[model samples]
Target: MENYFIESNAYNPWYNLAVEKYLADYVQKEEVILYLWQNQNTVVIGQNQNALRECRVQLLEAEGGYLARRSTGGGAVYQDLGNLCFTFVASEERYDVEEQLKIVMKACQKYGICSHFSGRNDLLTDDNRKFSGSAFSMTSRGKVQHGTLMINVDVNKLQRYLTPTQEKLKAKGIASVSSRVCNLQELNTGLTVDGMRAALRAAFEEQYGRCTELSLDMLNNDKIQEYYKMYSSWDWRYGRSPECETVYSHRFTWGEVEVNLKLHNLIISECKVYSDTLEVQFPNMLEGLLLNQRYDIQNIQIPEFHKADEELAKQLKETIMWFSGVWR
Candidate 1:
C-alpha cells in the first residue's frame, strides 16, 4: 500500500476544500492520502444541511467570516486558523474509518489528552467535551473522511455564528454549542496548532511507515481552481431555502433528519431532506428520488431505496418509508 501526505500551505477554505475533493475523486487504487489544512475564519456546513437553519449567514458575513458548504453530511462547524483539519482519502477497499481514527487518537495522546470516539462521528476528551467533529463520505474514485481538530478556537465566535438544530441540542442535552465543545488548548495550555500538526504527522508516519510528501506542483492545478469557483460562489454556498407545508423529523442513532414536503394535488411537488448523516450522496439525492411521487399518509409512493447499496442510504430509506405512515 502506498501512502502520501500533504500539508496545504493555503488558509483559504475554498481552495482547501477543492483540493480535498480532487484528491478523493482522483485517488489511486490502494493508495491513501492524508491531508492537513486550516481555514482562517469560516463556518463550514454539511452538504444537505439547511444553511439558513444551521448558520446565521448575515451575522457571520458581517463579522468577516466565510461560509463554506462541504461535500459531506454533518452539522455546521466553526473553523479558524487555530483549528486544524484533516482528511483521509483512500480507495474503497483500503478505507477504514477505525484505522484512520487511531492515527488521530495516537496524536492526541502525545499531548496528554486522552481522546476517544463518541457516538458515530464525534471525537471527545476523556471528560466528554468534544474537541473534534468528523464527517465522512464516498467519492466516485474512493472514500473520504475529513474532520476538524479544535485547538484554540474562539468559543464566542463559534456561538456567534452557529445555530444548532434543536434535535441535536436535545439529544446531547446541551443548551448551546459552546457548552458542548472545547478547544485542545483549553485542556493543555502547551498545545499549539503547529505542534498538533507535527504530532499528527508523526502518528501518521508511525502507522503507514515512510510516506511520500505531496507538493502543490504534483496536484492538478486546473481542476482545483475550477472546483474553487464552485466553493466560492453563492449558488453553491447558499441555495434557495425550501418552503414546504409539512416537515417530518426523526432522530435515529446515526443522525437527525427533517424531511420537508410541498404537496400539490396529493402528489409531492417539492421535497427537501436535511440531515447530518455522514454519507454525502444520499441526502443530496433525496429530492430527485422522492419528487413527483404520491405522498399520502395512508399510501405514499416510496422511492426505490433497495437500488442503493450504501448503509446510510438504507437507513435513511427506511426512515423515509416510515414517514409515509406518519403525519406532522
Candidate 2:
C-alpha cells in the first residue's frame, strides 16, 4: 500500500506507546503510516526530561493514571480517551513536518474551524487558544511525527497529573513560551471524534493518495508485546531524566548552586550537585552528602565547612534552605 492507517483498539498507554515505537522501528520505504490512537489517564514525558520533576508520579499513580516516557525530547503532556492521537511515520529522507501538519489543519477545516500551526508544535485557533500539541522522534529505521487532538479532553485531570517545574523550562531555555488549550468540541458542540477521524482520513488521502485501513489484530504480535513490557516497566517510566530534572538552583555571593535529585519513594535514590564556586570539587562533595537522604528540609545534613571554604559553604547552606522552603 502507498498510504495506510492503523487505529489501535487498546487503551493502556503502555500498549499504545509500544505500538507507536514498533511502527517507528519498522517504517517501510514505500508506505507512510498514519496511526490514530488514544491513552486513558496518562501523562507522557519527554525523553530528556526529569520524570520526577515533570510529573507527580505518586499522585498520578494513586489516582489510577499512567506515567509514560516517550523516546522524543520534549515537555510532558496528558492523554485520555477524550483525546485523539495521530502519528505520521515515514522514511527519513521523505519526512516532512509541514506536510504532515496539513493533514491536521485540513481535517479541522472540514469542521468549519480555522486552525493555525502556531509555536513549535501546536495548532491553535485564531484567538491563539491551542487544541493540540505535538512532539517528534527520529529512529534508525525512520522518523515519527505525532501529536494530540483535543476533542473533549479532560483538562482538570491534565492539571492534576502534570506538575511542571520552572527548572525544566528554565534549563531547556524556553521559559517564556506559554500556551492555553481549548477542546475542539468547545468550539463546535456537534463535532465528535468519529467525525474528526473521517475528516483526518480524507485529508490524509488527499495528501498521500489512497490508504489501506489495517486491522488492529494484524498489528498485535510478539514484537509489539515485548515493547509493551519495556514501556510498562518501572525503570522506563520513573527513571532519571535529563541528568535528574528535579533541580534546585539559586545564586549567592559565593556562586550559583544547582542540585539535581532522583527521588524513589520520597528518598534520594540518586543525586548530583552543580556549583560554579571557586572550589571545583565542592559540588561533588555536596552530592555525596545529599545522597541517600530523605527529600526534606529537616533531613538535609549540612557538611562541616573547611576553613578556607567556610564562606562558600555558608552561601551553599542558604541556597539549600531557600529551595527547601519553596520547592513544594
> Which 10 consecutive residues of model 1 have the lowest summed lDDT?
167-176
Candidate 1 CA-lDDT value: 0.78
Find the candidate with the highest TM-score and give its number: 2
lDDT of 2 by residue, 1-328 (tens): 4688988887898898889898889888766889998888998887766665666666777778888877776678888888999989988777889999999999999988898887677899988998888888888888999899999988888876675545542233121234688999988888898899889999999998988888888666999989999988766775434333366777777788887777654457787887888878777777776777755445777777779878657766776677655443
Can you tell me which runs of candidate 1 are displaced by over 4 Å?
Answer: 164-179, 240-328
Query: Tens digit of lDDT per residue, candidate 1, span 1-328?
Result: 8999998998889999999999987999989999999998899987765565566666677678898988887678889998999999999988999999999999999999998888757889988989887889898899999999999988888877785333221111112234388889888899999999999999999988889998888655788889999999766775422223566687877778788777543356877898888867657676776777755333444445455556756765677666654521
On the 0 to 100 scale, the lDDT of residue 220 in model 1 is 57
Error of 1 at 158 (Å): 0.3
Q: Compared to the true structure, candidate 1 yields what TM-score?
A: 0.70
Q: Hey, what RMSD does candidate 1 come out at?
A: 14.8
> Worst lDDT window (10 residues) for model 2?
169-178
lDDT of 1 at 147: 93
TM-score per candidate, in order? 0.70, 0.73
Cα lDDT, all candidates: 0.78, 0.78
